[model samples]
Target: MEPLPSLEVIKLDEAPLAFTLATLFEPSSVLSQKLVPQLHEKLKSSPSPPTSYGELIGLAIDQVRTWNVDLQAKFISGHPRIGETKNLSMLSAKEQGANSDRPTVQPTPPKVLARLAHLNAYYERCYPKLVYIVFVNGRSRAEIVRVLEDHLGLAHSLSIDEPALETADPVDVGSQKWLDELERAVRDVGLIAKSRLIALNVA
Candidate 1:
């Protein structure tokens, strides 16, 4: 939970930059391969490096916006699924109540819970190596199912005649609701957690 060194320091020191990126992403993730170089370049060229953790978060997610599928999928895979029993990060545990101490938190309905789990697995099959990212934001299970089905249906309809746009940038990819939602989830999940780290002076 150490706060990152100043962006100026990280800009000049490769070791610090790499460590900072590791704090934000899984070790050996595409973030190191795809995003860190770009961020490093920006840091060197810009008249000012990020002065605050919030600015750093913005820079990181902007790099995220440009990533192709392989990188994005790798980034997405780091997150634990909502309500999942394991692999939850500090942020996910707090946001999704994955590690709540409260005993009164109601369990999901049996059938609906099963369906949600099914959809998560089905999504992985549809886009191999990619986990579906959804901004849970306290939504109910039924609502999450609708969001999942809606995105999956959009992807299915678009790929009816051809394979989906595997390489297209999520933001620039043609009118795809599924991709849009996925990208937003990616941004939100990371931003919220990173911002929390910033506020607490944690790296």
Candidate 2:
């Protein structure tokens, strides 16, 4: 397989399978050890590989959702946190519109960042081993905060309705709301990846 291509080398239709994987996901050994190989096998058996990277990423997300909970968590958690201000990948930095080179751009306010950080911490506590991941998709920090707040409220309501989830196994908890959140996160991962691919000017 070709060495993982730099961001400059990833053109959806032309790059090798590993290039697409690296472009779509953060660096995770599980991706190299599992997801990439699985996708390669899938492409081999298909009548033809997907013409668009977006479709390929959708299939990857579907495969992730079918894995065992631990594996799913590993894959899902590879995504960056919403409202993160630093240490973003080139793709994530572009996706979040953070650290722009244009001088006219204003950064998210410190107060808003603080609130998001607090909410992120609370959210992780609410759902162990899960990070708050959203597509951001050009939404403002305040708007993203509202989404996070709404999610926390929903998680709280679900916990109240199914208190047993608190004591259930961390990896195997069967709460519908938690499971739904996981599925949503995986879906967002696809959305983010596809949008990034589009931004790459994939042909």
Candidate 3:
């Protein structure tokens, strides 16, 4: 993969900042709108923008989490569900083993996909507005399904409700197990971005 231009070049324009954020996270006009200005201000605040990808990503993560929980949940939900089979962002397609840049990998079997879909529904029902997001990182569908099953075991299958998230303490938005799932999804977003950053910089 072609390496992104140096940070020095990227900080020169909001366009590059938007592109970089979309590449690292999923492409979302809402997310870009919310993040690009903060990133630009951050870039301007320092004489030197973050000298490393890690610091830049840290800034991105911190900014996202500082938003209200509803927005944060929505942003995390923007990620394609695990085992999703359609309209994947390039980074997601590559990580899930189905990018045009790589040699063709066999399509996941319909049966396995069906199982994943069922599990995805269960997971979403268990925690409203939060989709199951994993790094995938090259795991097979079967393996991912197993992971989902294990996660479901930990989660309480509850009647999904529209909680007053805006006024409620963000930390208590869900059961502790549910919160753990959200935290894991957030961590995986950073992990996925780090992996993508590494791959893009590869020699």
What is candidate 1's lDDT per residue for 1-203, written digit by digit as tens?
Answer: 56666767888866788777666544455666767778888888888788766677788778877877556767777666644645544545444542234312336666656666666766665655567676555565556666776766643221222223353233333336557655776776576547455334564
TM-score of 3: 0.81
Q: Find the candidate with the highest TM-score and give its number.
A: 3
Per-residue accuracy of model 2 over 75-164 as CA lDDT, tens digit each: 878877776867767777666654333312247777777777777766776777678888877676667777877866533221222323
Off by over 4 Å in 2: 1-15, 98-106, 154-172
lDDT of 3 by residue, 84-203 (tens): 768876667767764435633448777777777777776666677688888877777767877777766533222232222232222235677666767788788888888887657631
TM-score of 1: 0.63
Question: For candidate 3, what is the lDDT?
Answer: 0.70
Q: Which residue pairs collide, candidate 2?
A: none
- Model 1 misplacement above 4 A: 25-28, 98-115, 125-129, 137-175, 198-203
Alpha-carbon TM-score of each model against the true structure: 0.63, 0.77, 0.81
List the global CA lDDT of all models.
0.61, 0.67, 0.70
Better of 1 and 2 by lDDT: 2
The 10 consecutive residues of candidate 1 with the worst lDDT sum are: 156-165
lDDT of 1 at 61: 78
